[model samples]
Target chain A: MGYPRLSIAEIREGLRRKQFSCVEITQQHLKRIEEADARLKAFLTVTPESARARAAVLDQALAAGEPLLPLTGVPIAIKDNICTQGVRTTCGSRILSNYVAPYSATAVERLEAAGAVIVGKTNCDEFGMGSSTENSAFGPSRNPFDLERVPGGSSGGSAVAVAAGEAVGAFGSDTGGSVRTPAAFCGVYGLKPTYGRVSRYGLVAYSSSLDTIGPLARSVADLAELLQVIAGHDPRDMTSHGSAPDRYTSGLDAALRNHRVGVPFSLIEEGVEAETRRAIHRALDALERAGCAVEEIALPHLANAIDTYYLIAPCEASSNLARYDGVKYGYRSEHFSNLGEMYQITRAGGFGAEVRRRIMLGTFALSSGYYDAYFLKASKVRTLLIQDFQAAFARVNTILIPTAPTPAFKIGEKTSDPLAMYLTDVFTVPANLVGIPALSVPAGYTPDNLPVAVQLLANQFHEKALLHVAWHLEQAFALKPAALAV
Target chain B: MAITLEEVRHIARLANLQFSEEELQAFIVQFSKILEHIEQLSQVDTQGVEPTYHAVAGKIDRENARSDVIHASFLQEKALMNAPESEEGQFRVPKVIR
Candidate 1:
């Protein structure tokens, strides 16, 4: 093996045996980051000094014979949207480019507490607004599968780092398919946990109601381990659920025999490529052989998911992102003489095109005359969409669909066409809208050598069930660990 | 159903964002396309369904509000230092209505 592409388990085992110190492992990831990140643009900032210092202490603790957590010494990348203490948490916006968070996000705090060394902060869509990382003030992250194409986005950098072997695993927030879409495009495993299952405290809010922080890893087990560490309630966040029961990583090895999996017929949508269809079939066949009862079901309203998501997400985003008036912790205009001038100039200069567009849409939707016609109507539509999912889950234990309509598109393919860009999340958005847990695992690849993923959606608080299905598929469809040759 | 440039400008004003003429024209076209797509949701009949404002299933305990536990972290301290304008340890913004 080139450099021992260590999963979290393997790295933990290696650490236990003292095969490599935490500092050594961290340095290896840092070295890979330095060598690979320039071309990939996967990271916004690499905290080499902090990572080394943290890793050194873990190494010292090991020398003193102290027991370490399972994720100890494992270098992981964090999406820039998630706050890390004393580190710049930009949320991929010029607005907060210099904004350093004094306290870490609850998820980041939990992961670091479990001894996971945060290697760097990865790039993201500005304020997690775009489906593609192209909306970033930073450059778009290149797909590790094909450098010419985008590594799917919003959470593109997190997905790219894990796929490119820069980090064993990483954290990313999913709002409107940010995590799973990029994970699918980059050919990595990503999980969007049930809303309220993971604490959103310290994650710069982007649509508070729909946003979820989750993991992107090379394998299902690694994703599972990362999820276990980060999944819990936080007193700091009122929206966080306290009573949700989870033994997510435990007892998942029963092997998906005699389980029912529903394949949404709407997955074969108008724009789906022929190869993407065949890839889903191949994945289904593997599941069938493994004793899964694969059946074709119709979630008719799923076709409307993208529409409901656009209205509801932007509306929530309009409210959530209103806090960055430039009078707070971020960039402020020096030329503004009056307060209105300050707000106008600072936001205009700080925000990008997509951010501006969403803000406008959201404001319009929530405006006095339009509230009932737009935001309230969209809210009602969201309930219907959730009901559709709840009804579908009643018939099936898991819902199987394509993560993206097709595999990774060219970097600039849909940037000009906003609707085309929005349509990429057609399949992934419904899961987010319903606040159910979902996972994207590499199903197979196109003949053109790009990766396509099959997504599995489970009902609310059904993370364990969703992951069990993903892990089963991961083992069966263990396509020869291929990645772009560095 | 095409969104006009005037509508785009109106929305931009409500958002408190400044848009150039070119941006307004582009957004008029783009938002029109998005609105065209989004109009499909209205076709679905959603009578009697409870609108989901939040994702969580159960009711939050309004009776069980926790006391504010202050962390002496730099985040609180920096919130003050990072304020654009402050007076007597409070953030000062423009007066709401002139």
Candidate 2:
């Protein structure tokens, strides 16, 4: 197998055995990115020079008999929204197209400290705004499974990079299914850690309360490993939890003899496609066979998650995005009569259509005379959704559901219908709203060969349990990682 | 509730944005549809429920105060590196008043 297709564990083992040098693996993966990224359009920036330099350092360390780091010389991609020191951190928008981050995000710093090679920054919806990468200003990333279909987004490029074997793994932020949806569409493993579990110090804010940086990998083990490296408390991010990080890979192989897996059957009945539903049921059945106690559970307020998310995320987004004025950084308009005109022209010209739509929606909800009716009401419903999850977890260890209502749709299918596109996140938003850990693992393939995935969610800070269940399910299914014919 | 064209324009103004006639017309329809979808929350019985502003609200470290001390920060040149126009190590913008 080529270097690009190797898992992080395999690469680590190979490096220790001297089966391959770090430089060789890094070069091979860089070559794969050079060859495959044109058709896949998965990366916004490829750092070949920096990657080689880092790999050379690691190779010298190995020669000197130094202890190897956890992710030594493993090439990975970061979602463009995560800042990389001296790298252009575009959130897939023209506003920051030329913007170079002065500092690295905390997650990037931790990854590099662990000896990981950052090959490039992957594409996303501008500021993590959309369910599909089609909203990306750079252009949407195409699914490796089918070029006609879109890679689900705003983490689409991250998922595509891992699925196409361009990178061993990738990091993407989840604010309402951005990571998991793309992972499901690309047939990779994605984990959204509980809010506050990971530091968001340099992650460009989308929704402060909901955004989380998580991993997308070819295997569940890699997902857990990457999460271990990046999950910790940071003084810079006050919201970061002070609890010690869990050893996520510790119990990965343990049997789920008495584990409780709740299936929210009622939530999937209406909008989910028949094939997707069957795939989820089959996954649950597999879990049952593996000694998991699969049972039906109720999350009655689940139907209200989408509405609550739409209102609250936009409101927070409107506030977070207000920093992009003409003065300090990012884009500025060339012609404007006054300061007020400059602000208007710069923002109007800098942002894309979907971003503008969201900003406006948020502004309306938070505007005078309507804040109580829309934003506050949505917040109350968010509380109700959290309670529903708490109640379900009281009876079950982890909740299981379909990652997305349907598999990846055609590129332009739902772009014209804003509401329809929003509905794509119905199954995944609850985890974000409640600050719980969630994961999406490949379940099976559809008749058309598209990938379908099942989601597992655990209560807040229960990522180890969630990852344990996912690793077991992943092995039980024994599905092969996605390989592109190209 | 159906949003009026005037309301759309007002919201855009509040957001510090401007749209052409064509874009505004399209937004009118899109906003109407999205707002209609969001209207479902009105049926939820949220009576006596407290709003959750932050996902992990009570867990925030409100008392983790640092001592009053000055530390190193970004240099002036680096801070202004991404600005569209800069002079004398300061971002340049249009005058606020006539």
Candidate 3:
């Protein structure tokens, strides 16, 4: 299990220098997954035969001395919620436990076309609903740093996969901090690109407006490379934009020249753990040393984001998930006497408690008289929250905040209180609400040896500048999640 | 503004989900807390602001539909691959009337 941890950059460089064949690299990663995944429970399905088959083709191409594609021979994991043709994609839900997608998602197709080796499908909270993977029907994915602690969800497994060196890079979807929270908890890099920056063609929709597939990796360069390959418009996803992706890797080493960073002073001043506060300062100090300007800014409507999101996300999710009736695909209950009873019992037996709770909350929110008071009011607040980001970004290139209020907590810490669990995503929700791009970079480890992170966000489609500043800040902090020794 | 158990049952019927008595009791307690949390949204002055139904509200052109052109899609077999019960390329479900 002591395999060398190589970033996508290092893999390309090594492959070019004839250090090892594509099969060797893929096997090394497979070996790591085999050795560490038992404890981490990161992957729901490990496709060894297909992975080896894919690697063998790359090996043949390498023997033919072919030019390197952008992501040649790089091993990557996909979140189970994103469809993979002919692979069992459970979405960590019992409802779709046996479902095999007939076609791949646009992002998965793009990654494979770029010569990436598909390693496996990783676990997630059922249908990407919960902030912690405890809602996963298959069971929660454990944090690689500490087995007793929870890995942030619903992309927890993808984060653990990259953190444990099971894969070179991974793709996870972020609706409300699904990607960034897990990355922060696991001490890695995860980027949630601007809404419509990546297509959602074959993705199983949770909250369509907020859901976007993103990459998690051990390095910013790998994160950028993954983003570059998967970004751009698709005819299948009408919301996806048509702009060409920028050369994401071209500015990884660029200096943070004239970059003004804004922090919502009062937001972080309250309720955040002291150690987490110190970690944010550590990242800001490093950025300041590298010539970044840090200033306090106001985001008056920010505190209402969590409540606004809970209402809006569940509302959208209820509509999107209406297709899971017993007549269609997925699980069907055996206890029903009639068609209507079948629909009710199928959903009751098929969905977990949290999923049903959200659906109930959403249905109530949209019911006859409640729609105006609940959904409408929440949507107006959403507008106000969006305006808050618009006002904040006017004064700075990017906003900085702690990725989470604290490090990874014990497994059962917040599961008992869904409201308590939802509050953990307090700082990460505004970006999703405004449809902006946000990146979570590991700031440092806590005294308890858990990792904490600082988040950076840019206005819509400004990933290039955001990533440039992130790369600078990454260097200023200069730490590796591979130090996890999984 | 507390949620009654009867309303909880009504919402479950609307959502087409079934819950045991025990689960409903827990839902009443937990969901009321969540409802209380979101009640603060009404206190914010959103009088003149338009509700944002979609994050990218006007950015997408939803008025016009894609052209009525035939294209490749999942075949009946592939589409029904995951159905629990199917016959003659159609998903089978319990009879609506008996």
Candidate 4:
């Protein structure tokens, strides 16, 4: 019989028991990448030489009878936006296509220090700005389940990599559902930790206030392990809360005796697919059977999440992306009469259509007469949304919602209209807007076999409880593992 | 409110991006629709509400401020490593002076 998929736990146990050499495991995953990445296009960069070099070091340490590190020899992929020293960080855009970071992100530094073998950088939407990885300048990463369908994105490549078992775990940046949507679509567990749960020191900023680096893995335990390594405060990012991270791995087996799962019923009743609605209901039933009480909760301001997110995200993006002019690094356009034209022409040539559109919308929103009307209005609406979540959390232990409105849609389906694509993130954006920890676990599959995920959100810095409930839901859906088509 | 081509060009310019005539025309339509949709923000009663995007505030300034001492940081060459054009270990830019 074929061996079970290489989960993080399996890799750790295998290495500890001397069942396989670290280099051998690394080579196996790299070979898997060579075969799977051909059609999946899940990776922008594959660091076989470096990953092998690191794995060899682990092997030597094992031969010396030394202890293993937390993620020793575990092949992990980073989203292209997160910098790794000397490795290319493109943010999946032509603007920084050839730019290589001089230093690594704090999260990357932490992951490597914990002994994760860096496999490569995965593709992402340019600047983490799109719901689908189709916004990647290089190309869209196809879903491992169906080549014709998209792996839900911005973090689609990371999700694809984990789903296809090319890497045991991966990191993805979530600005507005970048991590969760892809996780849901790819049928893996994804966690978007509370804002500042992990430092964003080296993440190519899309929207600083909302941006977070998160983990995607095939199992809840692996997701917990990955989060344990990366979650902490850094002096570099003051927004990274100074509190110590909880023992996320230990609480996975917690009984759901106190998990008050609240479902925002009316929020999903309209515009959401009937099948997805059924899946969420099914997940609620599983949680109830597992000894958790489920109730209908109201988050009224959630209806305004899309409009609020599009406005605030772009506003912050317009300011954050202004640094990408020709002067510093990255693409510089040819033929400019003067300095002003150089900046304009270079940006025109460098950014993609969606990027340009968002920057335009952002600039317009923050302009002289419109700031109070558009930007400020969106910010205040953001406060109301947070208040809704706050009020709801007071009544319920955690909130449940669909990770996305539907399963993975076809490539090129929503690309024609940008606004239509924006609606897909309607369910995922509120958690970002509220700065809470949200997780997506596979609930069920559609008739076509695409995955549908249910999301759980906990109050700020409550990743422990959030993951605990997700583990409970994950146990209920244990029979359905991530189906690989690669 | 309808966005005009002139306004679209103005914002694009403000954003330091140049758009062609066709690009600007397409943008005006898309931008107008996005603006119209986000106009729903005006319908909500946000009276006396503070405008905030982050649910939790950043740390207190007293705690956030690092010490005034200078510490190790990127050297000039390291900083300029990725620049499209570098001269004398500094990023070279188009001449700004008239």
What DockQ do you compute for every candidate structure? 0.57, 0.78, 0.68, 0.76
Question: Model-by-model lDDT, in order?
Answer: 0.85, 0.91, 0.89, 0.89
Taking the tens digit of each residue's C-alpha lDDT, what string does model 3 give over A1-486?
A: 465578887889998998988899999889889988888899999999999999899888988988888999899999999999999988888889889999999999999999999999998999999877889999999998899988899999999999888898999999999999999999999999999899998889998889989999888888899999999878788888766778888967867788899998788979899888997788788889988899998988989999999998899888887888867678888997888999898899989988888898889999999999999999899999889888888889999998899899899998889999999899888888889999999888877789988899998899988789888877777774445646
Tens digit per residue, CA lDDT, model 2, A156-205? 99999999888999999999999999999999999999999999999999
Tally clashes: model 1: 0
Q: Recovered native contacts in candidate 3, as a fraction?
A: 0.74
> lDDT at A109 for candidate 4?
98
Clashing pairs in 4: none
Chain B structural similarity (TM-score) per candidate: 0.70, 0.90, 0.89, 0.86
In model 2 chain A, which range of ten residues has the least summed lDDT? A477-486
- State, as a TM-score between 0 and 1, how close model 4 is to the true structure: 0.98
- Candidate 1 chain A lowest-lDDT run of ten: A1-10
Candidate 1 lDDT over residue span A192-248, tens digit each: 998888898888898988999989998888888999998876777787777655877
After TM-score superposition, the amount by which residue A63's alpha carbon in candidate 2 deviates from its true location, in angstroms, is 1.1
Clashing pairs in 1: none
TM-score per model over all chains: 0.96, 0.98, 0.98, 0.98
iRMSD for each candidate structure, in the order shown: 2.4, 1.2, 1.9, 1.4
Model 2, position A395, has a per-residue lDDT of 92
After the best TM-score superposition of candidate 4, give how far the Cα of residue B82 lies from its true spot, in angstroms.
0.6
TM-score of chain A of each: 0.98, 0.99, 0.98, 0.98
